[model samples]
Target: MSKKVIELDALEQINLDAAGIDIGAESIYVAVPPGRDTESVKEFPTFTADLQRTAEWLKKCKISTVAMESTGVLWVPIYEILEHHGFEVFLVNTYHLKNVQGRKTDVLDCQWIQQLHTYGLLKASFRPPEEIVEIRGYVRHRDTLVKYRSAHIQHMQKALNLMNLKLVNVLSDITGVTGMKIIRAIIDGERDPYVLANFRNKLCKKDEEEIAKSLEGYYRPEQVFVLKQSVEQYDFYEKQIQEVDQQLESLYKKYDPPDEDNYKNRKKHKPRKNQAHFDLGDSLYRMAGVDLTKIDGVDALIAQKVLSEIGTDMSKWPTVKHFTSWLKLCPNNKVTGGKVIQTGTQKTKNRATTALRIAAFSLSHNNKSALGSFYRRIKARNGPSEAITATAHKIAKIIYFMLRDKTDYYDLGENYYQEKFREILIKKLHKQAANFGYYLEPYNMAIPLVS
Candidate 1:
């Protein structure tokens, strides 16, 4: 009963005595044969220290292939270390190993993982090279900083509102040329909203003298200070965002990943141009459905975050649902006797999912999008949380096709679903009516098949 679940029979030519190591934040537990199953599990400090020493110990034990669970982002360093030691490392999902009651422990986890590795029941999770990972990290960090800045801006806006400043009523963006000038003056101790209004762009139709006169307002000194601080923080984050953009430009040039123009360019263009199209290590930017800007509020940083979280090799998945399920975006099922079931969605949503949801929320207001329509559809049916997830799932599927197939994406337009809406409604109605004994005749009156 114990046999290898081989993917390719050709791989039968290769020798395997694969080991498994369950890595935890606190420690690492490795499993091997010819030792007390659970007792032989070797524990090591989960740090950069003694990485070489660990490799040496593994070498002495003659361990070749290794498998480990993906424990958040912590698994990366260990994976890199293991890979450097000339061992075939398989980064796997925890879901693959179903631990029963009274059968789970650090040692047992390692043993179970090892058994899978030996039997080839494990598949390596998609991992781009270190440079791509580095690129992704920078991009994701930049997005976090952007969100932080936006939050600060919102807080500042609330402070301004509480101060009875009607500046927002007059100006489109408080950070705009005229508004900033007026805000700066106020923060620098000017007590008048009228003065801020007067700071509007020279092109403003509002009379400056009259605006300045109306800007007068009673504002708390403490509130002004808090607003000023928030504005200053927001500015600081803005500066950081620009710096991150500069950093991203370099990564974009480095790993262009596959896409429509990229593939065509690769085939038609020379090596010099091809180098420009894909990353030196791996071209993640060029992957399928890599809009890099499709989801609402997803800038370069967010684009990098989504692509980096799940690489472009979608063929590894049977479908977009499979990919999303792997990301733990779907329900985890517990079934008995194939009749009754306990089902609930994944308790932990991924970081990428959070980022996507945030972007989807921002997209709700964007009328220039298929994404907006998708958002509205889900939001109408469920709630904001489910809507966000639905949009994110749609995005994930899009990304899967875009990267894996190296295709181009264009928004189908907001009316896309609407255009086909009647057809969809009719089909659903037909199904329901059929069960209720209300048969629907074909619009064209059923034509006989010309067999």
Candidate 2:
């Protein structure tokens, strides 16, 4: 009798070929691989009950790997459900699994991912680790709430401006203390914007005086009602932002220095000399370092935005160019027979690039910074835009090394290759000077006079 042996072909690490799940908001399309006995693909709904049923159903099939495209946040729930159920699940990128135009259909999208996956042809994007994923959700939702609040604030501004309430003219913030009090009084049937502006606290006396001058906009009770709704929405978002910040504060401890609070007393006392220097990820301030702030012109916020979006996972990128290329930074190359078509990448208008631009602009005014030198260095050849990108590209490389190597940043010095270039220049100049019979000395010699 032959001993029983388990035969496997479709299984790779992470269950690469069991089935394919394509997710939409309300529905999910699952594609079971072609079986020896079946001809058409398997189809199913992906409801909670249906998902539980799928576990029992898939066990009956001989699928060894499960693959799916990450459609949206919708894909996440199902992916977790399926992965939790022990199916090999792949969260593939839509870019990597592009289908031929005519052959594309929703159901076929799942089928395509399955087909590519079965043949082991699927490539996936870099997903952050589980900790990063969880942290990302919190950070992303906070961003959405912030944007929502901004929209509400803008609507209120438009409403007030429409009413001709010079409240904005008098005060920088219509939602500010003096402005809010006057707006509320107006909504409550206060006639005089003057009387309303006077509703200031002791701290708001100066603000009140200025707001009174600008409280001259047109007033309608109906418009005031509309403004109230928008103000409420703004308040709701503010609350949400606060809650998220609390969560972030708790999570930040992992990256913050153990003695962060000690910084207050750092001027009076020093850390133990035996202690090691810290990495950038050690604090929000330190992490700001990777954001190219040392390059000058890069703001803390922009630097933080870059780190927040991509995390410190430079290993996903082999080089700094690869990282920027992923960001659509350099240029998009569409070619036929190696002839170029589009010269530059589509304008992404990403925060990271904005930070880089800030750095570039700063260089224009900053003569002491290496970023300033780099800007001048490249501006002579490529112009401001390219020079900024070149500087940004350099910053990205610096960021990668800082994050991946877990090292402190050291400036390359404004004259990074100055000694080498000087040596070469001296040799060339001396060769000519020698022919002319005039003795020459190397320009870089610290003591020019021979002692």
How do the predictions measure up, each by TM-score?
0.70, 0.67
Model 2 stretches with alpha carbons more than 4 Å out: 1-18, 24-29, 32-40, 52-64, 85-88, 99-109, 170-211, 254-304, 346-369, 372-391, 410-451
Q: What lDDT tens digits, residue by residue, belong to model 1 across residues 131-209?
A: 6677678767865886798788787778778877766666666666776787778888877555566567887656776
> Looking at model 2, which ten-residue stretch has the lowest summed lDDT?
267-276
lDDT of 2 by residue, 1-451 (tens): 3657887787453443356667777666667766622633555566788776665566667665677776756777666766677776667867667652436687676776666676677766656666556656776686678778889888888888888776655566666666677767876788765687678656653565566666766777677888889888988888887777667555655663534553332221123211112322234443332324443454444454566667766888888778778666677778976588667665765555665566566667656556567678788888888887777776666677877775545455667645555678788988999899997854686756677
Best by lDDT: 1
Tell me the lDDT of model 2 at 145: 82
RMSD of each: 8.4, 10.0
Give the runs in model 1 whose Cα sits over 4 Å from its true position.
Answer: 1-16, 20-29, 35-49, 69-74, 92-126, 150-173, 202-215, 218-232, 255-302, 329-335, 340-344, 358-388, 410-416, 427-451
